[model samples]
Target: MRTLLVSLLSISCLHAIDHGPYIQWFQDPCHEAEIRWVDRSGFQAKEGEWSRGRGGFGYGDNDDQTVLNGMQNKYTIVSIRKKITLAAPANADDELIVEALYDDGFVLYIDGKEVLRKNSTGADAELEAPGGHEAKAWEKFSLGKIASSLKTGSIVAMQGVNDKLDSSDFSLDIRLSIKGKTSTDLITRSDSWEYLVNQIPEKDWRTSTSLPDAVPWKADAQYTLGYRPVGNGEMTWTSANSHLFARTESKVFSVSLKGLKADTRYEFSIRNESTKEISGPHLMQTAPETFRPMHFVIGGDMFHTLPLLDAMNIRCGQEAPLFAALIGDHAYTNNGNPDRWYQWIDSWVTHCRAKDGRLIPMVMGIGNHEVAGGGFFPENNTPTPDKADEFYTLFRMSSEGSRVISRYAVDFGNYLSFILLDSGHTEAISRQVPFLAQSSANRKKTPFLFAAYHRPAWGSGCKDDAVDIQQKWCPIFEKNGVDAVFEHDHHTYKRTWPLTAGKRDDANGIPYLGDGAWGVAVRNPSKAELQKRPWIAKQAPINHLIRVTLAKDGFTCDALTADGKTFDSGTYPLRK
Candidate 1:
């Protein structure tokens, strides 16, 4: 009888694990859709003329009442597009439902096919042409003949809304409420595995043109010893099913958990020993000592914004990454104050999770904003006691015997190696270069190697350069075959074609990937500014988290949006 009961519970767990398909939710016809907008200044706009600006909240129960009044200035016109895909064909009589809040007029198109034009006047002849608009809010439009429209790959529903030329305040907010069947999502961690492994289906994980080998792992081995690495200090760990308190004043501080079966999945929670307050029942996985297949998310510059922060947390849930390589600038409070730092730290630990309620663990790096004396104001070239104390206090550092918790390296068996550097925040670049060089030289033949810092050496037109990094670290990264250097703090997205000495040399060079947009909903870099850096192969002005994976075949990196889709992806071959 007991055996039968156990089998039933196991079946229930397996059934619960399949959230949906292996890829991100392509469409949810029942719920309101997500909108991507591009604003154009003049009436005469070209198809490729609009810049990709980032900042759109998803719609749900309050979607119809959603207000998008971010603009206080009266603008000329706004163009937007929403990509909707269906898993199965819709009925021929199905309709495309949309509600809008516009100042002047609007034009709508599904799959580039013109559906309706309301109040559009003056020079709006072509379907792609912009027109003058009129004031309207909560205007509903149910256009028929959209139920079975299928484009080659994906369907685009475009809308061009115009604002009154003389209006004092301008804003355009719209929602596409479609009724149809849509492709859905399946969480990666499969419960069918007796061992820990990332279960992907049909090699279609990217959901885009890029084919990145999304490696999950099979860690059937055990640590043997009970001691596991958690935070700066070591702690003995059991499984997440039980509570293990840190032997400190705060019983619930972050600590590295060691001594578990390799490639295993576990859920953990933190409890304040004194108050009995609990923080998480969050999920996590262990690193396999061998290169089975693994991926991790990395970025920085959170700046304490809730929406953007939620985006990072949301992506973590979707990707279910092994760990996040956080390269600094989380929470804009740079000034050294205990209360401010504590507030930021509290927020960071509480959020930052995967879509399936997995709490993320960060492999941290120190950015200028991470310290007390560095910011838009003056910067001290040296480290102080309070600068990165909060970070050090909140997380574990595997710095070996060194005192510099700000910089360290973690070895995931022979599979991967990471040189997490301090980038002049806690230690001057000149001082940390020797250690970086030594570490790089030793790991020259590793299958996958990465170096991370807070600032950029070859950024996209902004203060992307860190003189010390350009002269000191760049030489080492280029010479030692560092696959890529993860960087942040510029608040824009960028990827360089293999670079050597600040120039693109694709033949033999290191690609600098970042301009952290994790939680900062800052504006995208102007097109003009983006053109200034000829070395940048790709750039996105959106908040994102970067995922790099060491697959069975090669190495892959993708800039994933908050919605669990790959905005841009690149895969690299391993060195001989």
Candidate 2:
């Protein structure tokens, strides 16, 4: 079967295409990049005795460059520049099969930005300073997986391959292969429609505009711990809920812990592990074990709109709720650049200051923009589960062993359970049924139930609704006697009367609120339509965050405008 598959691929193969070993060399071994221009002369500058080009260069003990630091020569560092020009931007899903064969640690920079590394630890200077051999063999990597924005035209890529100023051997070999200057809509799923890749300008953390420093917000129960450290490092954290207080030699962080004490507070932080440099002694309080009034902010479509995110953050901070549940579109972080997501998140962490000093916890759900197909980072105008794993690496949602942290339940207290749904960005609607049914069925006497997902089952903007969700999850919600269902995606805002089987039924139907307007622009419902249609309880075209207050027997929710004024409100009565 495998042979047959290969034969079919070979038979249907249209062509084999790849471009460029484009090259140039610099001798400075940039200690720092900005304000250190050597000019683009296409030749070597003679400062002392340094040069460029390919060669079997080796140094003996005491060579000036090698011994410059005990170091011999001054040009121990050199950069190979490859100016790859694409007639058209490569497809977002397209990958340049980078072939790298080198000695010592090296750093790669695309255009001028340093994309998150490949199998590397530490910073570029350290990597460029020397000591990497694992990638010495020809190893293939993908460019799209590293860069956030890859577009048409010329791209200047450079890599600094290092050897200790006194090392015996050093070499540099790198290349990129992809469907260059061509369009290829990346497929979203095996049977789903395709979409385009995002083509915004790339951001260089070194120079990209940064927000003024605000108080940093700590990670919550569902927070993502960056990456597992490579070599010797400590992964340290503490959880009052779980009675956890320890440091591990290995730096692999986890999220969504079990056995945590309800209603207790926990303190945690992220460190360099090696440096013991800490991010926080910040605190996060767990949901209470008993029923009580709880406050939380709900919003979505936060597509890098810093001001909107800022307003929401500050507003939520002022409200100082138990947590913030963001439905989706946190940031349009494409090309596997987790930093893109973190940077936007950083904006919130810093600016979203509470009246009191406490880290606001977060509950998250992935939207279409968050995924490739759902809309956000479409490559070659395509979407793919192929690279959506990047989202998972940064967040640890409630899904225990699932790649898509789209669905799961978080207990707010004995009385309320937020059952989060994965609206088929990467996972199928059908596949989520088992989990939905299971979570809905086992309520543990928690009468107040709320549900959240990205796309609304009934919206007023685009398509007005999602049949997939209506069919797949609505029945389950109804069976479970859900108090209210929160959803976002259409960028418009609307609340439906209690709905059951797609129609408004006041007696036993589930109410649907939110068409999602957190950071994205507003698409208010047509005013005429609002009057003509009675199914919609209320509708508005504005950027607002919803606030929900839950008590033992009931709950109240209100949509608050950017400046923190209530525009829409609803109350769900006690469950029978």
Candidate 3:
């Protein structure tokens, strides 16, 4: 009975994982469809007319599983259909929830019946997609009491429309989930083995990725020790099942361990069931929950120049900071190429470590190059989350579940806080202001308050400031007493004299500490170029990371090169 129950539980757990496929068809501009028939059951697409891929289908957004080739200038619509074959009929009280990540407009149909419409017009065959829409995070719509409509073989179809045929990008993807009695998620952890071995020494897990089935682990765990590293690892962990949180992307999974003491260190390991391979017994420490003495590394624009980045990564690891704030421009993988990310992660996993061998937890913000169609930020246009799909998937902290809201705040036990902003990559700069204001205001009392983003509002390399950021967010930082602001993307080193209202005011100014020259080719501005920008207190064409230490009295920052040389240092007292 026990064996059968375990087997059944394992099957149930596997079935609950939601990484499935959908059939997609990008509309042809030369011969557009005059009728919409794919939404109905038994509607078979003509041979070679449709392609199958995971959710998220579209063009130019790099993250799309099914790229609508040549659709940017030729067509403005793509239709996606998924067949739901539930094992049994849904209960009358069961709730059906549909989550969608879309851009411009879309119309949803269930078994050929119109169900929901968003930013779109017309009906069935005449559906029109006028441009000028920005895709945000996942939006949820409820099909209340429509349990009977969810019968087996029913087709859930969506037509994703672009605002214009020449628009920069378009995307649409969805998930149909049911919630009700007997719909409990299978919470059981699998991959069980009898004996627990701690044989493998702590090494970078990227080698584990080479193990055919080895899943690369990110530094996102909170505390609980016993856990499975995504991709079918043994569940012979010591912690209870309740503490394990499973996150899935395609077939690979990431298990987050929760409910552990803060600022404490723990050892963990994973065993591969397929190869009988043992890996880890590695160390990870939870972020501090209270104020004492702590330090962290901060920089951005990495991976373009490999050797420089690797050097900086090694030097950063030696700092033994609590974490590294690698804001943006990672890999320069402009169009969602997996190989670019693979190399970047490999280097990070190998070199970005603490002196004591702890993998440095990374906190990041999105940048222009992260988008699929690189540097598409027009003053009036907004991009979608689909543009930077890999960034969200590659880093756990940058997103909430599968939904990536690019702006978020992380607080450390009332003493320190970081407000990470997305500088018009996945979200608009204006839209982030309210969040920036609220986050800054809430952290006013924090002993060490900092804001980090990819673009510099007042840049020395660039001709002008990010007008939107300067007009909207800089005031909030000054008003809320932010001690410092870390800015990046110019490929040069910079430190500004504390300024308020666009001028130096040492008594009431927030220091802008970076122009982001981590691993990218440094931009050397001559004295003539330097003389053009009066906001700079110090500027150099050098690659370095800022190491900051916080104490009860105040904090200090040191700019260090990859070879471990401190070229610049400053001490700042807490703002009262």
Query: How do the residues 1-576 of candidate 1 rate in per-residue lDDT, one tens digit apiece?
Result: 433432343233222121000111001111111111011111111222222221121111111111123322333445443334455666666666766655455565555556667666432222222444343346777766565664334433333333433444333455554454542221111111111011111222112222122221211111111232233245333322211111111111223333455555554433333333333333445566677777888988876566668557656646867777777886565544333343343344334444444445556677877677665221344765346665554444435454635666777776688888877776667777778989888888887888888888778666646776788888888778788888888888888888887777766777889888888865576778777778899988878889888787778889988887788888888873
The local distance difference test score of each candidate is 0.53, 0.52, 0.63
Give candidate 1 misplaced runs (Cα > 4 Å).
Answer: 1-256, 267-282, 335-351, 376-380, 398-403, 526-531
Clashes of each: 22, 37, 2
Best by TM-score: 3
Please provide, for model 3 over 314-336, each residue's C-alpha lDDT reduced to its tens digit, 9 standing for 90 to 100: 88877877778888898897645
Decoy 1 TM-score against native: 0.54
Residue 225 deviation, candidate 1, in Å?
A: 17
TM-score of each: 0.54, 0.58, 0.58
By TM-score rank, best first, the candidates go: 3, 2, 1
Task: State the displacement of the C-alpha of residue 482, model 2, in Å, after optimal TM-score superposition.
Answer: 0.8
